[model samples]
Target: MTGRKALSRALDLSLWKGALTTAGSREAADAVTERAVPNEPTVRLTAVRRLYEVSTRMGAGRSLAETLQAVVDGVVTGLGFGIAVLNLRHPDGKFEVIAVAGSPEAREALLGTVSAADIFDGEFKIADEWGRLRFVPHERLPEGEVVGWVPDVPVSADPSAWHPLDALFAPLHSPDGELVGMLSVDLPEDQRRPGPIHRELLEIFATQAGLAIDKARLTDQLLAEKVRLEASETTFRLVFEGAGNGMATLAFDGPEAGRVLRVNDAFCRITGYPHDRLIGSRLLDYLTDGDAGRTRRELQELATGTGPYRFERTFRRADGQDIWLGGTAVIVAQGKDQPRILLIQIDDVTARKDAERELQHHAAHDPLTGLANRRLLQHRFEAALQRSRQRGRRGVLLFSDLNHFKQVNDRYGHEAGDNALREIADRLLTAVRHGDTVARLGGDEFVILAEEIDGTDLDALIRRVEESIGRPLAGIDVPVTASIGTAVVSPYSADLDELLRTADQAMYEAKHRDR
Candidate 1:
């Protein structure tokens, strides 16, 4: 009896193992079939296949609107809903109808009239008072209405018969927790309560639909960013290549003399050299002999990170032309390597410097007479006085005023007066020694500073100035004369302001005497 019992137990164990194997195989097959046919009998297997194909095609679409319309069509066809509406919220906190399908009248009624408050707060009401069965919001229903729309229903029951006409609302949410839109399905009372399986399927579809919407939005955002970046890069390249100023980058390896690393097209155009010829060439090779040692030291100091250097230096261009460059050098490091002494920026300021020198000339000289203006004369006068005082010598200040300048201007116009001034300046310049300073102190007034002179020599200088001014002006046939007053100051009594005042008084006395 014991042997038979043991054998029976072993056979039962073998039967159990076989049963487990068969059950596992059946489960795997069922999984494959479910994947193959996602929809149930309500939706034919072929319909499910077509739905997937359409979804795949729509997924490859570029426009978000097209993709969404395809999704809405697939869901409506697959689920057999009477009315389907896809509403999307905009950035302005308003809901917009994105996709709709069903009766034409119903679609037109729901298009732009729906709002967030209408769907979430307001209740759907079904009434028999109207000739045709229609669903309206509860607020629109008259007072004392007995029958209202279905409020809540079980997930497992057949809602089609119990609540023949009802409304369904499902919120579409994105993965990042943004409320994208609301999906609403309206059906008759007979199709009110959806079954457990149907509800589960709807939930799955909703999740997948949200993911598709997010993917479409992300694709659009990426495309826009790509366009913006490309535009920015193009703008930078154009400016770098077409700018009128010269720019160059030098690499600092060991400070033996930094070499040119990169140069823009403007640099090549300005220097008359091609980019290939300048790269890897030492910057010191272009410097003139007078500035070579200083330039070398400056580049070395930049390599040591002392300070930024900026100065004017003459460089030999490729065509053997000497040009002035206003250069600036600094130290920079792109990576963890040692700091690169970047002799980075240089501007071909030859034209600007030349213009600046011309401007300086205009500032120091009078336009009408081409003589030194008062500002320049004052600067020279102070320097001469200081020199005379240091050397214990005497100097004379002669203040001269034209005798009849206004009468000449009134008779012959300002142009002839200007010619007279020019002629007088030329004659006075010739009469004075090269060391003397002559200046125009505005309308019809002039001054001269004669330094390192004795009393007799001073008198002779004054006589020469008077003779030169009395001579006939070239363009004007009239003879112009100037009344001159001389003031002499030795180191003992040389006060600039007092001497000027005394010279003015003496000038008035000379004019009175000439009159």
Candidate 2:
């Protein structure tokens, strides 16, 4: 069977020879045995030197396409082929050209023709044995048919540098004998039929190419993963450093608990600290109620996966001014064997909180004289009523009207009356105890709330109001006296309007008596 196999192989070689030319072969068995001897040592050494050079050059490829292209370049440079093409096998069991390298004119012409035919990504039928090799001589290939196939590869473009009249195809196979792809070669006219020695060299190159291709593809994948990871990290870094609010990471355990681990640019600016100075400093030093103990509890919550914590706090900047900061904190677990840490975000709320207090003051007080308006006076009235009922203390609500206030306005002009009213408002403020509430019910009407008073103290308080209002105005020449009346808030009579009405009726009687 081995002899028959040898005979069959010899017959195949002979057939190839005859097909490329009108050559005849010797007896089949004799021809097979004669061609089996090794070539000269010098030729083998020369091939070795060139192939080594090709191997080193092919190492430059970092991707699949570049590597496959390097393989084609190696075949032309190492094996001295005029042109070389690396083709890949597709899932449909057909081959398509992927890479090309050769003489300048041949490469350009062939590539142009291949592109026009869509041969790079397109499939072409080829047998499994083609992985062995096949040679097609210029004469055997009918110009009408084969030349027509590459109709666009113009011969007149650069006839001197482009002459590849004969070609060889050597298909590559994996170790498992599975066909991977093929390498096509165009030999010089003088050495159109390469010896067995040359063929053997081509096979060695094909094997190296397969291994190189695998490596290149793996490298390509690793580089792609690296690029994706770098992009993700860049995006996170931009958000952390560029955000308007402050952000920081803190140590959650050990002696370093509450220590600032890292702070972004925003945090640094907020705290008036440089990046180097802030790191390793305890965060509690800059925060109110942010001690190590509190931080540990926060860490515990994070370890237990509770949830994010939110609160308003005061942070001391480097300049020693306290700033109100609204903040959110959360524990971030770093997995087993790694200590968990805390993430926090803070925003300045000092301005907002101050604005809120100002709004409350404006809503409850008179804008002109900065005194308690009716709204605040009524609020005080309810509190006084509740206190008198609970504590059994006597309380009085006094109503006072400026006597002849409209007359002062008509005689001295409204501005002088305003001056007189301001003097009266000031006198009313000083006449009573600090605990008492004095309010203006618009225009010339004023009310005073005095609690925890006996009958004697209430009478003395009324005398003081009468004396204060009787004083001359600072800048106005009007004599503004007040018609004052008082109502006792009994434990059984807690109604606000009833007290106000009783006070009003008594004041009307005082005015009539003065008239």
Candidate 3:
């Protein structure tokens, strides 16, 4: 018979008066049988149709507990049973009531009452006393427990007992051979016992249910991953497009020229060019006039894989202003045609370069007098000595200490002393030749490097410095004297330290004579 026809026959058999007669005592059997079979087929068909529709509706059910509950509801209502319960194997190998349906009393009594161990062992003592017979797998049951029912053993034994008659338990197994849970059913004692037909039906239902549950779980996981991936993409886009730093990509075309493929807003702002104008333009179009050829050659070498170059260059901005850019460019070709091309990265370094130049000026020149400081004087003297050695020439190193300068500072304060030093520096600068270097050696002391000078010329340079110092200050009319000492050295003298010491000693001797 077709499934619908078979269902009609089962309904007819369940409602048969003959079956009711064999159910048990007339009064009790009639009452239970009346409740099991409705007065009309329409009500029964409606229940069956609703159960089938809902069970088929299990599209993406993730939770095992929820799916099990759905199964319990569908089986009990659809099959015209009084009660249904679902039991699942716990992690510890015990069984727990996962879901239950039917009367409140039946649900409470069956909930958490039985376990897999109890059912597997055919421990039906509670069911037997309650007029209920437990069904186990034929292969699984103990031989003694597989007994045929005798007439003497009343079907409706007692109401207070643990088990119910017409109970069916079928293991719910997944497609991968995992036993997920068990489906159990109960009916009044007078109802027909569960047989192979009922077992087969329950097994099919459980298989469909299990597959639906797995699908739902996978769907939920995929949705969560998709959300995370989209979120990551949003974060990346915000950082790449909204960053303050200039970021761009250049497509390599040839040695000196490449097209700008992408540029962020910061790049446009820094280069003073619009995005539309910058894209597809050659990188060399912005290069300063003097660096065009050299940069082109470097880019060519980079493209040919012959050199790695990193240097600073000046670029003309959109407004025709020159801006210093410090950056590196390299060749990048991800297996494309004409692989010889350059990828350029540039950053505005005008502020940084200016700060470096200012620092260098402060290090070598005195802040107050604008003369070369002691450090610069030492460097120049060493360079001059090296040159003198190469040409067999001699240079004079003059160390001069201002005599009685402390009295001026003590009497007039440091401000006036500073003015006096400024006037002295100007006089020394005027007295020295263009090639000579005059430096302040700190605390009212000065040093002069006279290159390619003999003894006579050295004496003249010293006298000119002394006369300038002794000249009266123009505004303050303060007379100052500087005691001068000179040390001559050739590059043959290997000891620079000894030369500086001799110069210092001679300065002290001249100070003593002036005093």
Candidate 4:
């Protein structure tokens, strides 16, 4: 079957109207539909319709190679050419015979054959320009240089008759005016050279072929991009859902800011909440009340693209238990049409947090007395001094020592001495006011820091400590008494060492007086 007839059967002509609509050219459609004027030449009217048919067939969404073949076939069978060849340009500036028609032998021999760009340039140099078409007459042809696919046809006796060696080319260009290919035709069916009218029809068909090729290439590119996007999305889904750590995507802007848009199974497991219930819910809703306000501020800073991505936060689970999460978040800014998002990933760190708190408590407290040790005492002393200065309040530091503590150990034994020390520690705790710090500075020495104390309050505080310590021991038969000394602290209280020194000296004086 002829190539045009085969193509017509393969493509749907119902697409003709649709093709015209897609091209955005209502004029072409109008020309096809409009009735011919009175006494219009039957030849011109028939030829115009042929051009329209060829254009719509090319636009019927065929593959690029198929479309190129159809273009050459339409030129031969539809436009009255005995032979046609489409030479397509390559990146290296060479032209390859991609499609041919009119003669079966020519199609077999010329298809896939390449021609150097300079060879076509040499032919055009000697050819006459017929508007957009180039006409190379037999007499003008260069010697010893073959141009394109030349058919074995005999020369005519008449000077104006179409000759076998005579060449005609219509340059096919992209919409951008780049020469993408060349269409060469020879042996017009009338056995004469193509007139201006025939050249104009060929020019119009070439323009249509160029546009169709350009559109087909664009469609191929779009299809390729779609395939890549689908692949990337599949990879992302696998990583996001199968991750070991809890993961969630939150909206970072608009009315949905801070709200969870999606959560992986791990995140649901960590929060003890189901997937359906968590969507559109604020992540801060799961935070403990104590941490809510502070966490909200930090999240706001993070959303604004500031602050560290790493954080440790406590969240209340569905079962009313608190869990700690240590994780990092990635903030995705809003692009042209993209929504701002926060991709948060976390691991359950409740056990780690509990261990850390236990270690911190042990480091700050005395193991023997269960009271503040020297390290903790210094920290409290510094804070109290700051408050005293800021509030213009007065405080006092009371230093005390057990009288003859070594003698208690010697008479009652070291175990009994330990029991006696426990009793003294308990008494010291009760004797001090609320918020005061009582610390054991090793064996037999205890210090109390009392803030906002007046002269009368200081005197009363000292008497209470002596009375508390002077009581009988719980297990030891020996009596226990403590010599107490005090140092007044004003807003001017500067040195912790000087305060402790003054209190220590007074305690020794009291011990001497009591003896």
* Candidate 3 per-residue C-alpha lDDT over 384-438 given as tens digits, one digit per residue, 9 for 90 to 100: 9889989999988888888778877887888999999998999999999889998
- Give lDDT tens digits, candidate 4, residues 50-120: 65555545555347787788788888767877667788887788888788776565566567877676647
- Models 1 onward score TM values of 0.46, 0.48, 0.45, 0.49
What's the ranking of the predictions by lDDT, best on top? 4, 2, 1, 3
Q: Write the per-residue lDDT of candidate 1 for residues 333-356, one digit (tens) a residue.
A: 322333343534456778877898
Worst 10 residues of 2 by lDDT: 1-10
**lDDT against true structure, model 4:** 0.69
In model 4, pairs of residues that clash are none
**Candidate that would win on TM-score:** 4
Error of 4 at 422 (Å): 3.8
Model 3 clash pairs are none
Candidate 4: list runs displaced more than 4 Å.
1-242, 304-308, 333-338, 407-416
Considering every candidate listed, which one attains the maximal lDDT? 4
Total backbone clashes of candidate 4, pairs 3 or more residues apart or in separate chains: 0
Q: Tens digits of per-residue lDDT for model 2 on 1-515?
A: 01100101111122233323432333442344335433455455556556656655565555777767778888767786655766666556655557766544344434422222223221122212232455544444433433312211212222222223445666565422356666776543223257554665675566556545544544552112111101121111111454345777787766777778777777878778899988899877776665435655655665655434555667788888887776656554433344546767666778988898899999998776667898898888888888878988878889999877787889888887777777788888899988999888889888888988888888889999989998877765667788998898767665778888999999999999999
The parts of candidate 1 lying over 4 Å away from their true place are: 1-245, 249-262, 274-294, 306-324, 332-341, 350-363, 511-515
Give the clash count for each candidate: 11, 1, 0, 0
